[model samples]
Target: MAKQRIGIYPGTFDPITNGHLDIIKRGLRLVDKLVIGVATNPSKDPMFSLSERVAVVERETHDMAKVAGVEIDVMPFDELLMKFAERVGADIIIRGLRAVADFEYEFQMTGMNYQINPNIETVFLMADPRYQTIASRLVKEVARYDGNIEAFVPSMVASEVVKRVNESKV
Candidate 1:
C-alpha cells in the first residue's frame, strides 16, 4: 500500500474565495487528502465567524473533493501551524504564492516549519493568473463599499460578505 499523502493548507480564509478553491483543487492533485485550516486567530476579529468560514469552505469544496477523489476537511484551529500540521499527520504544507511579497513571508514561514518538522515538506503553488490579484482584505474592502465581488469569491461567500457588511452597518 502507498503512504497517505496528507497536505495542510492553513489560512484565515475569512470567507473562502474562488482563488482558495482553485488552490485547493490544485493541492488535491498533489495529495490524497487536503485539510483546509481556518485560522481562529484570537487577536484579529474577522467579519465572518470561524464556523462560518469553515462552513463556506466545506460547502464550496464538497463537489470538487468528491469528483477529484481527494478527501477535503475544513476545520478551525488556534495554534502554531506546524503543530496543527503535525497533529493532523500532514506530510506536506501547501502555500499559495500570488506575488513576491507573499513568497517572502511564506518562504520565511516555510523555513521555520521545516525546522520544526523536517519530515514535512512545504509546497508552493503559484496562483492561477486570474486570481493573482484577489486578496481577502481587498475583497472585504470592496464588499464594504458595495462593490461587486462576484469575480473574486464564490456566490455563497459573496452573499456572506454582503450579509456581514450589512450587519456591520447596523
Candidate 2:
C-alpha cells in the first residue's frame, strides 16, 4: 500500500484571506492530508487572537476539506516552522506565491529549511490572478477603515473582522 502523503501549510492566518484559501484548495490536491499550521507570529500584530484565527481557519476550511475528500487539521504553533512540520510528520511544505517580492523571502526560507531537513520538500503554488492581491494584512487595513473586505475574505471571516475592528475601537 502507498504511504499517505501529508503536507503542512504554515502561515500566520491572521484572518485567512481568499488568497490563502486558494493555496489550501490547490494544496489539498497534492496531498492526502493537510495540516494548516497557524503560526503564533507576534511580529504581525495580528488582528485576531491565536484561538480566533484558528477558529476562522477551521470554519472556512471545513467545507473545502469535505468536498475535496482530503483530511485537514488546523493547529497552532509557536516554534520554528520546520520543527512544527516535523512534529506533524509532514513530508511536504506547501506555500503560495503572489509575486516576485514574496519569492525572494520564500526562496531564502526554503533554502534555510532545506539545510535543516532536506527530507521534507517545499512546494510552491502560484496564487490565482483573482486573489493575487488579497493579503490578510491589506484586508485588515481595509476593515480597519470600514472599507469592504467581503471580496478578500470569506463571508463569515469578513463579519468577524468587522466585529473585531469595531470592538477594538471601543
Candidate 3:
C-alpha cells in the first residue's frame, strides 16, 4: 500500500484569521492527512494561549475536515519546526504566501528547513486575493481599536479576539 502523504501546517495561529483557514482548506487538497501545529512562541506574545489556540483551530476546522475527507489533527509544539514535522511524520510542510515580503522570509526558512530534513518538502500556497491582506497581527490591531474584524476572521474568532483585547485593557 502507498504511504499517506502527511503535511504539517505550523503557525502561532494567535487567533486564526481567515487567511489561515484558507490555507488549511487548500492544504488539505495536497495531502491525505494534515497536522496543524500550533506553536507556543512567547516571543510573539500571542493573544491566545497554546491550549486556546489549539481549541480555536479544532473548532474552526471541524467542518473542513469532514467536507474534504481528510484527516486533520491539531497539535501544540514548542520545539524546532523540523523536529515537530519529523515527530508528526510529515512528508511536506504547507506554507501560505500572501506577498513578496512573505516570500522573502519564507524562502529563508524553507531553505533552513530543507537543510534540516531533505526528505520533507515545503509547499507554498498563495493566499486568495480577498484574504491576502488579512493577517492575525493586523486583525488583532483592528480589533484592539474596535475596528470591524468579521471580514478577516470567523465570527467565533472575531468575538474571542475582541474579548481578549477588552480583557487586556482592564
lDDT of each: 0.90, 0.95, 0.96
Q: How do the residues 61-168 of candidate 1 rate in per-residue lDDT, one tens digit apiece?
A: 899999999999888999999899989999998989999999999889988888888999999999999999999889999999999999999987888899889999
If ranked by lDDT, best first, what sequence of candidates would result?
A: 3, 2, 1
- TM-score-superior candidate, 1 or 3: 3
Candidate 3, pairs of clashing residues: none
lDDT of 2 by residue, 1-170 (tens): 99999999999998998999999999999999999999999999988889998998999999999999999999999999999999989999999999999999999999999999999999999999999888899999999999999999989889989999999999
Best by lDDT: 3
lDDT comparison, 2 vs 3, better candidate: 3
TM-scores for every candidate against the unseen true structure:
0.97, 0.98, 0.98
Clashing pairs in 2: none
- Which portions of model 2 miss their true places by more than 4 Å? none
Query: Worst ten-residue run, lDDT, model 2?
Result: 132-141
Model 2 residue 34 distance off true place after TM-score fit, in angstroms: 0.2
